[model samples]
Target: MTVLPEWPAGTVAVLSTGAGAPHAIPVSTAIRRGDTQLAFALALRRESLVRLREDPRCAVVLLAAGLAITVHGRAVVERELERIAVVRVDVESIQDHQSPRFEIDAGVAWHWTSEEAQSGDAETRAAVSQP
Candidate 1:
């Protein structure tokens, strides 16, 4: 079954088009199908929808706390006239940085942000130091 990272990965970065740069955004929600597939619920007119229509190959990244999960897959945008659809991904690979390892296979790699390596590092860095 598709497993969530140690922390909740609430957003992903996506390319607007096949050859465009990555654009990251917080996803509205994600739904799991069985154990190896996932569908991201999104509005039909979003940038991700436009890009997926032109090219089904894309990477979906999930970030939370300090862990990042990047999945490469062939995406199918099942859109309806109602302007809403699910971006279904036939997961080709999965990756994780921090873990005892994810429950699901068909994974690629794992990565931990610098902040995560040291708890509250990001927050500490963001805070102004009192001289």
Candidate 2:
């Protein structure tokens, strides 16, 4: 197995699903498992989750902390909790898209506007972290 580059927790990434048009969404809960696997949780009602259920093929784009790469893989629904679906991606390829012309200084910033949402996010992250 190919070990993937280590990315920090909460590293901003875009999860792309589907085949033709490709539905993409910003995901902040992505976590690296060991070396070759990445995992994230999505709300059960999210259309992206539905699309992923239909097509396991997906890609995660990361452009943060001076790194720019696209991780392509196949996703599998590992489990489902009360309100979120935990998905694990078995990484197949890591394509570097970095250029010397420019450098990335930081990752996408995110803030919660409501305490309820923040609490829920924390719970989701905890669930995703479980074995």
Candidate 3:
């Protein structure tokens, strides 16, 4: 079981999948439902939907400033709201990147997993450069 973290504000959320070659889509309306569930709104019948339907496993990356938070999990179609569908993800892993970090320079990025998730490691972070 992966413990999830709260996504910070002013960041971009990206949904990624590994159904075939890696794929990712920018998510705009994602919100955390609880400690274990993450929900995001998207258009119905999108490529992201097809990939997720084929493989529920995915990663949601939140980026803001220069910091990134990645959450790996399994997602399901919760329901539909008009022309959009709501997807709920069960978080399974968490990796937070912070090195000399501050609220102003926090950045998030999303990517499809080329391999299965592993426990969080410290080697993935780089020095946060100020612009």
Candidate 4:
């Protein structure tokens, strides 16, 4: 099982077939309960959600400082309220791009419970810039 460290706020690159091109959407994410799960907010009209419904396969890349983690997984969308939607991902594998660190192998289920969900949205401007 690949144990991924907490995903800092960043743009999530969601692969979808509906648009005929992969869409990279900037989203805010929070990890609750010791990396047990991740929570993010999204607008109601985003195409990625629909794509996820059609196909669960996706990827998320997070970079902070010089460290980067690229993850490939199957995502299941949970709740939808107004413009906010929560997504749960079953992580299949992750690649650390910074220095060739440990890699998360296959067959790993990334679970997220309601209690561990964070309550707010991620800051867009803060997440998009690299420092």
Tell me, by TM-score, which candidate is best: 2
Summarize candidate 1's per-residue lDDT along 37-66 as a digit string, tens digits.
666655666886776777788766655555
Per-candidate alpha-carbon RMSD to the true structure = 12.8, 1.8, 13.4, 10.7
Give the TM-score comparing model 4 with the true structure, all chains together: 0.61
Off by over 4 Å in 2: none
Better model by TM-score: candidate 1 vs candidate 3: 3
User: Poorest 10 consecutive residues of model 4 by lDDT?
Assistant: 122-131
lDDT, residue 74, candidate 1: 82
**Clashing pairs for predicted structure model 4, backbone only:** none
Model 3 per-residue lDDT tens digits across residues 3-93? 5556553246889998899999987556666777777766776889888889999999877665467889999887665556668888888
Tens-digit per-residue lDDT, 17-97, candidate 2: 995587999998998886778899988998889888888999999877878889999999999988889999999988887
Q: Which residue ranges in model 3 land beyond 4 Å of their true spot?
A: 1-3, 8-10, 65-67, 101-131
Worst 10 residues of 3 by lDDT: 122-131
Measured by lDDT, the strongest candidate is 2
Lowest-scoring 10 consecutive residues by lDDT in candidate 2? 1-10
After aligning candidate 3 to the native by TM-score, how far in Å is the CA of 55 from where it should be? Answer: 0.3
lDDT of 4 by residue, 64-84 (tens): 544466667776666666555
- TM-scores vs. true structure, each candidate: 0.56, 0.90, 0.69, 0.61
Global CA lDDT of candidate 4, please? 0.52
Q: Which stretches of candidate 1 lie over 4 Å from their true place?
A: 1-17, 64-67, 99-131
Candidate rank order under lDDT? 2, 3, 1, 4
Better of 1 and 4 by lDDT: 1
- Candidate 4 residue 56 Cα shift, in angstroms, is 0.9
